[model samples]
Target: MKRMLSLVVTTAALLLALPASAQFAKPEDAIKYRKSALTVMGTHWARLAGMAQGRIPYDAKAAADNAAVLEVAHKLPWAAFGADTQSGDTKAKSEIWKEPAKFKEAEERLFAEVPKIVAAARSGKQDDLKAAFAAGGGVCKNCHDNFRQ
Candidate 1:
């Protein structure tokens, strides 16, 4: 019994010390923190999109839950991308600052995509949802391709 108690205490201590984002910190730990959080957001988004697209069937509660997470995480990764942070582990390019208008458009596209995904998930329809998510992802990919390395 004493041994078991010690093991349990050790496990709890370790779990408290190690956050989910621990593996993803960059040198300054900005983008890494956001991306780690974003990854959590993305996992749900992919599931809902897959279901919405018909790879899996719609699960209403799941859609709601995942949508909730994605809504926030969608906005996080961009905050860390200031002019001072133009290097290392980022998909961001110098063009982000150079062609501000185009970058803004890309950002807008992603913003637009998230709401639609949420709407579709809320509507509880599987049909055409996958395509919607893929289109949203395209916005993300477009930005990442151009800006992030």
Candidate 2:
């Protein structure tokens, strides 16, 4: 688990270091990169969600750790959604490219919510974490429902 977390953190750091114009050599590479990033985000999210929904024992330390990982992982996937990546081994819908502005707005909305979850987790309040998690997950569902297949 530590190894996987380290790998996710390393990958997130590398992706975040790239310039805005960074382009994958092939569309498949972009798809793979985004999918990997999203997988990492989802893994962390599930852990937090489980705690929030009472399915798992809520440990303040664990919640904070997962939220911190999520803070980085959440930002990693958006950069890989290049125009050329619309068609590939991805669940991304065509609307993502065709309606870039709307997609970006949705992305921005998600970005806006992540910090709240981070703050709530760091506060060591399970109720706060639950509220923030619900809000953030709603934003995620909006994006997934509209932009993913």
Candidate 3:
């Protein structure tokens, strides 16, 4: 866990050093980056959701592991949503650019909620996990409904 956390910290620091506008060489590259990050986030999110909803048996260690990955994964795609990347192979709606404030609100909400999930998972309590999952999922779904196609 320590090694994984260290690597995540290092990667995040490196990413942060780059300007968002210069992160991608082309619009399609941004789209691909966004899609790849979202896919990774979605995969871990599904595992946590399954456990919370009882589709998959709840194991504290598994929840912790998934949530740890999610902590990093969830922050990835947002930086790729620059203006240059808006017209690519993406399902992102025009509303995202049209209503930047609203889109940003949704992103902030999700960012705020992810730590709660990490905390709940670390708690080793299924009920806590369920509550956090519901709150976090609501933020995620709201973004999909408003910004995504």
Better of 1 and 2 by TM-score: 2
lDDT of each: 0.72, 0.87, 0.90
Q: List the candidates' TM-scores in order.
A: 0.69, 0.84, 0.87
Please write out the lDDT profile of model 2 over residues 1-149, one tens digit for every residue.
99999999999998878853375777788899899999999998889889888899999999989998998999989888877777867889999988999999998998898888888888998999899877776888889899999
- What's the true lDDT of residue 59 in model 2? 98
Kindly report which residue stretches of model 3 are placed more than 4 angstroms away from their true locations once superposed.
Answer: 1-17
The TM-score that candidate 3 achieves is 0.87
**Candidate 1 residue spans exceeding 4 A from truth:** 1-27, 134-137
Name the lDDT value of residue 83 in candidate 1.
57
Query: Lowest summed-lDDT stretch of 10 residues in model 1?
Result: 19-28
Decide which is better by lDDT, 1 or 3.
Answer: 3
Clashing pairs in 2: none
